[model samples]
Target: MTSVGTQEKTRPCPRCGAGIGGDERFTVWCAACDWNVDPEGPRKEPRRLDRTRRALARRHGEKLHAGIVSGEDLRARRDASALLALVIALAVHGVTAAVAALGIWCLVHGWGGWPMLPGLFLLLLAWVLRPRPASLPDHVPVLHRAAAPTLFALVDEVAEVAGTRGVDAIVIDGAVNASVQAYGMRGRRMLVLGMPYWEILTPQQRVALLGHELGHYGNGDVRHHTVLGSAYASLITWWYCFAPEDDPAATALELISNLLLLVPYWLVTGVLLLLDRLTLRASQRAEYLADRTSAHVGSTEAAVGLTDRMLVTDSVEAVLAREANRAALAGPSGYRAAGDRADELWERLTSHMASIPEAEYERQRRVGALRGHSVDATHPPTHLRRAGLIAGERMPAAVVVEGDRADRIAAELAGARRLVGRRIILDGPSFGG
Candidate 1:
């Protein structure tokens, strides 16, 4: 296996198509490509790096698309896996339930002598193995149709374009991110639109973001995620349900029983880990396909611009939040003035970013290379997405609304913004007052 440095030397410059010299192999900047390589990786021409990244993204997208196109088969396989997991869970509980019933019968009858002991033990085991329903507490505020008509209308339009059912509800929060997912046994689709995230983008960019999220539904990615998630949850619950108590062993029998219990825990955990690893690549591919859908619905430029702005917006928000906290600490009045300070800082950051050239902005943005496969990651890395969007074919922009109409639509969410702000302050610790 050749080292990365040697491979860099052998590859041609992506920009000028010039051969990289031996000295340039170790340098950060490629004289020919005029691009800086990330310090984390071997030096390579920027354009070449972009090309490689794009190629890999495209391949992943293609495979995912192929799987999606065979929708019936994919669904069948997912259903089978889910059914198998469900059967296993039910079987485990069913056996415990049977044993408990037998124990109860023995206790009720005149057979309470030795039969009561096994019956009581079996009852305890059944109690421990009882299934626990998955519950996720609602942390963000959810908006209704009457409360956020404009936002709902915007979502409806995007859903129509993306060919998915409209979201059941919209959640507004203070984070700088947006997402769509299904929840509850009814599988109600919910759109989580961050107030800070919405404030940073133009009308077109917002549509692109909405389209990207809604695209997940159209491509069946949401269902895929749900199946995988449910299966993993069932396995984990089973593992925990039978987990041995933390009490120290008082005798050889107790020690043996504790050791025996660990066997099922490790086996279930190993299966869960393996499943996660196998599904991670597919999850990343779903993200890329969603990006493609966004590009198709709202132009490649809009999709790409949203990704770029996201990187800057996160940094700007962090800096402003810290500054606001510091000011609030100084005086009582500062607590009331924190919002104004944040607005001022945000404007400055946006203006500075706008004034910079695209190349300079790209170089300055601290995005890393495409991430390798990981069991825990649900989305592809930002840098890989940036490159892929850049290489994607341009499409005519899908205009949902523009000019004063867009402004009016955004204005309708003022109440939501206030709610989010109040929630943030209320939930947060007091600085001075």
Candidate 2:
């Protein structure tokens, strides 16, 4: 009665000699002895500066997580580091204002003279140095409150529980992630849901995601604020302006240009690095606060589930890749119309996610701890976040999606689901886009 498809390939772990099971195409590791887990280790950073930043972020992130687990409050305060970062940001803005004023003075005083050339140059520089406000991304379709009333209603309910105003727009995209970001100088918020990620979540975990994102509004993350964020952008601009090209062979003029720019380049780089260090701790703190908010709004069990799902985001991408590869190998016959693919992709994704083994989840946790795995430089490791959530206070769900309401929300997202699914099928996975 045994089918060929049901047979697993077995191998001995080189380190522990424990039996490991997997198909030929999949990686197999010994779950009992934890051998070959996280075999590749943490990804290497090619740049020395980037490597240093990541090391420091990981160290501080670990300390912050430990504090949270030991009963430290998740709320961010006006700490010394945050205050210094704010002061530095204000100074950066002051420099921008000075450049603009000097440019204006040059034009007003020397209207029809040789100074006009320098005046125009200065103005151009000032324009390039100006602070940029956040804007809506063009890559994804925007859903207005009118079009997605049911989904917006759910977001609004989560926002109320998380103690912030809801978003102005919802962006549905193909990535396996979700985020809330401020747009425009007015700081109007927008929530982005990556349907690939959203489709794999249980209904309550979706609310947890909403809570975590909206919680950023009140999380006291100085770097996400308009002033500080724009200031950082301005510093990056200065660094780019003074940075030398990496050409091995160069003319004398290019060599002299690099020499002349060296001092300013270092000056900009030092300040940029300093600003990053000053704000790094507060940023990590804000993430913990957001995680707490997620637990508060969606209940601890749901929030924990959400964190576990984050740990398996790469697995979701692996499933999509397998589907892509299968289609390629099958030639024209395997190709499905965008409509058919869109309709079926969500079901396939949910099934794969639901079937992930308990042993695999535990293995991933161990790997996270070993590698200091994080969503990015700003967030703590997933294992630590999960631990913090488990140790923290539990609460009843402040916002729950009833069965009918969940169905209604899904109906509203039908068009966007198809759009995102089509993108994945045609273009592979567009992560963080």
Candidate 3:
């Protein structure tokens, strides 16, 4: 067999096109690119598992490309999977409950000696298999309509055009991403907008983002995921309740029990993996449908631009974060100054993207394409989406907001931006206390 160092010499670094040198250690670093790799990292799935995932992704891609599976069909399949999961959960509980009941009957008939052990175990199993209710985040600040009427008005317009229910609440966050979530038993809608991400986009692009989020509701993606996610969580809870502990078996009985537990462990894990694989394709399709909805409600150009900017914004954030940290370390009063620096860096970086050549930009995007397809990814690769939009027929321009109306909405968001910035500084790496 080839030595590890020799093998590493043959492979190029993923980030920089330089040969990598490997030692026998589990961790490897590429000097040329400053890239680090850990063989035992969480991203390193087993080879057989990787192969199976690739095969599933390939099959799904083929079906999607061939038009063999419609978005409606994928939605139906997810719903069916949710139903099947529920049925399996109920069946397990029913069987366990019956076993527990039989043990109770035996005790009442004076047959209770060793029967008590099995009865208790059966009752525990039934309790473990019980379905759990979904959880909502606590302590999250919810923005009311009175505080940001202009923002809420924009969301209302987007929802009306997308044919989705109005957002029940809005949340301003510190991250560079935006999302919509369902909360409570009624599945009330919550629209979360990252102030950093919002500050980077124009009014038109903002509308596209809003449309994309609300489109999840219109496409039933939210409902499907809520049901499926809850079912998966219930299965995980059941698995954990009976999972074997990490201790060596010192006796034959202990070893036998451990071996038996492995059966259910593998069975439940397999089911979870299968459910993940099935729903992942649906999730990716939903992203595309949502993108289309965004293009419909806003302009196709705005949607495409928003997608491209997202790819660039990640890099921008990383560089600015380090600068902010450095600024904070310079002096006793540096923390407040760092926050302002972050805003300036964000604006500069975003503005600079427009000057880059289209050819160079496309080349940069292809780097993500090289990472290979994601089997369990929530969204398709950014490059793939951009390519699809470019090759497709042009859409009619549908400007949702413009002139003073857009300006008023953006002006209103200034207060929100300050709050988000303060939150970021307090929670950010630059803050010491």
Q: Estimate the TM-score of every prediction.
A: 0.63, 0.88, 0.67
Ranking by lDDT, best first? 2, 3, 1
Q: Encode model 1's per-residue lDDT on 163-279: one tens digit a residue.
A: 777887887777667777667776777888876677677678888888888888776663245544555555656667646666664577867777888887777666655454445
Residue 217 of model 1: what lDDT? 78
lDDT of 2: 0.82
Best by TM-score: 2
> Model 1, residue 300: what's the lDDT?
86
The RMSD of every model to the true structure, in order and in angstroms, is 10.3, 3.3, 9.3
TM-score of 2: 0.88
- lDDT (10s digit) by residue, model 2, range 1-433: 2224545768887887888885433346788787777777778876555666677777778888889877776677777877888899999989888888888888899999877888888889989989888788787678999999999988888888777888999999888889877888788888889998899888999988898988888676677778888888899899889988678998889999999999999998888789878987888788888899999999899999998888888889987777666666767766656457766777778877766766667777888888777786557777888888898888778999887999999889998888777777766777773
| Tens digit per residue, CA lDDT, model 3, 66-167 | 442232333323457545655654555565567667757655654547766776666565566544453344434467788778878888888888888778
Q: Whole-model lDDT, candidate 1?
A: 0.59
Give the alpha-carbon lDDT of every model. 0.59, 0.82, 0.62
Sorted by TM-score, highest first, which candidate order results? 2, 3, 1
Clashing pairs in model 2?
Answer: none
Off by over 4 Å in 2: 1-6, 9-11, 22-25, 106-118, 247-260, 320-336
